[model samples]
Target: MTTHDPIPARLAALRTTPTPELKQQWRELFDSEPPPFNRRFLESRLAYRIQELVYGGLKPETIRRLERLGEELDGGDRKKSRIRADLKPIVGTRLIREWQGVEQLVTVTQDGFEWQGRPYQSLSAIARAITGTRWNGWVFFGLKNHRRTA
Candidate 1:
């Protein structure tokens, strides 16, 4: 017997829904003002919320396990957890940028970053080396927007 699955349709509709309508839906679903994030974020969160409402959210044990994993990743520090979740790239990932017609490459490491045969403690330092001026490394490397908070 075939049973209708409405969750897929609900998720698909999020892509076409207008931003204001999505915000309204967010308010109703989340019981709060919609966050000041982009339309994509709204759509994605709405999709997840719709499915979560129908299928039930994660189990308490699963949630606790995820929290423990996050703590492990950030050494049990909430501030560090947020920063790492938002800013830290996977180790060994290569970040490449072009400055003054020269290509610069940086490798993410466990401790920091490696660039130009030298290890650096921060991407801003590498950006300074490449541009000879203070620059937000994430912006210079095109990893994130300047407005994003850690």
Candidate 2:
């Protein structure tokens, strides 16, 4: 006895659907404007949203557990958690940037970063040292843009 599952079909259809149609579906399903992301992002998120509508979202207890885990990972700092997960590079990864006429190199380390035989806590500090003015390190290093969504 097999039950008809429309989810797979819906998910598959998203891959071939036109961008405008996908945006329409997103507006209908999410009750908001579609994010200005790539076609692949729209398709994947639409697939997830389709499944979530059919099967429901995470349970409250599960959400609480995840929150607890996130708190533990970031020492109760939400901003730090997001930064660590999204922006922090793996240890030993070398970040290179050229300013003016000289090339700058910074190495990701276990504690923080190492640049020019010196240890620094944050990339912003390194960026400031490289340039006289204040700057957002992620933007300066091209890891992120100035106009971030969240």
Candidate 3:
């Protein structure tokens, strides 16, 4: 049951195979219907599942060590570590936007955002103040984009 070649070959083949063939491979390997995810998701998960079968999954101790490394890199605090690294703006970074023909500037401080020499808790607040309406700060400043529809 520990065949390495066909598993990787199948995983690789998944990239070029049509959806029906991918589902067939899913049935053969997992003995269940594949989730209705896109081709990339199916291929990546199936590749990992194939590898998991051929070589046993990661050891618990190894997983713990990796988690510890991640925590250490993310400022050693669990709360900070929980924040997505991409979402955090580096200290001293300046954000600028134009609203109503006026340019607004915000500076990223160690604790929060500084706008017009005033400390604010969240970007949405700044966006609301600038636009005189409710707006998602991240979206307004382009930190985050709206999710794409399938």
Candidate 4:
């Protein structure tokens, strides 16, 4: 059997300005959503609250206090968000738009060609392939590569 405890000690350590009635307020809020927070949408609720806390001129202090409590909390670390579709495919692959503004793909950054911004780590692998003269289009084109080294 498992037992759960009310988050008192953790909340006590984060007492920024006393709101004695705050527990009542929290209880009322919990009464409304008794399922408890365990989803991305639930977390996003606290995200807005935390963002406001940071913007309210308590970012550093909040970070410190939260770090203390986070050491005890299980799911304290935030998850990384996924980039949009446009940036998603291009994360590890270098693509380009031709005169028709279509994305033309290339296997390697060929000689005498110039690139403005860095694509991704795939750039390093492609560069290494080109320099090492082991350039293979079949290996790179539309291939999901996992290199233990690189």
Root-mean-square deviation (CA) per prediction: 4.8, 4.7, 4.8, 16.2
In order, the Cα lDDT scores of the candidates are 0.89, 0.90, 0.85, 0.41
Per-residue CA lDDT of model 1 for 20-139, tens digit only, reads: 999999999999999998999899889888989999999999999999988777779776766734467989999988788989999998778999788999999999988899999988
**Total clashes for model 1:** 0
Assess every candidate by TM-score. Answer: 0.66, 0.67, 0.62, 0.18
Candidate 4: clashing residue pairs, number: 0
Write candidate 2's Cα lDDT for 44-130 as tens digits. Answer: 988888888899998999999999988776688656766745458988999999999999999998668999999999999999999
**How does candidate 3 fare on TM-score?**
0.62
Error of 2 at 32 (Å): 1.1
- lDDT, residue 103, model 1: 90
Clashes of each: 0, 0, 0, 0
Per-residue lDDT of model 4, residues 29-143, tens digit only:
4455323433443434433444454445456988998777764542443431222233224323454334234344443332212234433344334434444555333333434
Which tens-of-lDDT digit does each residue in 1-150 have in candidate 3?
775567667667778988888788789878999998888988887788788888889999999999989866765788877776667698899999988899999998867799999999888999999988999899899888777555
Indicate the residue-level lDDT of 12 in model 3: 73
lDDT of 4: 0.41
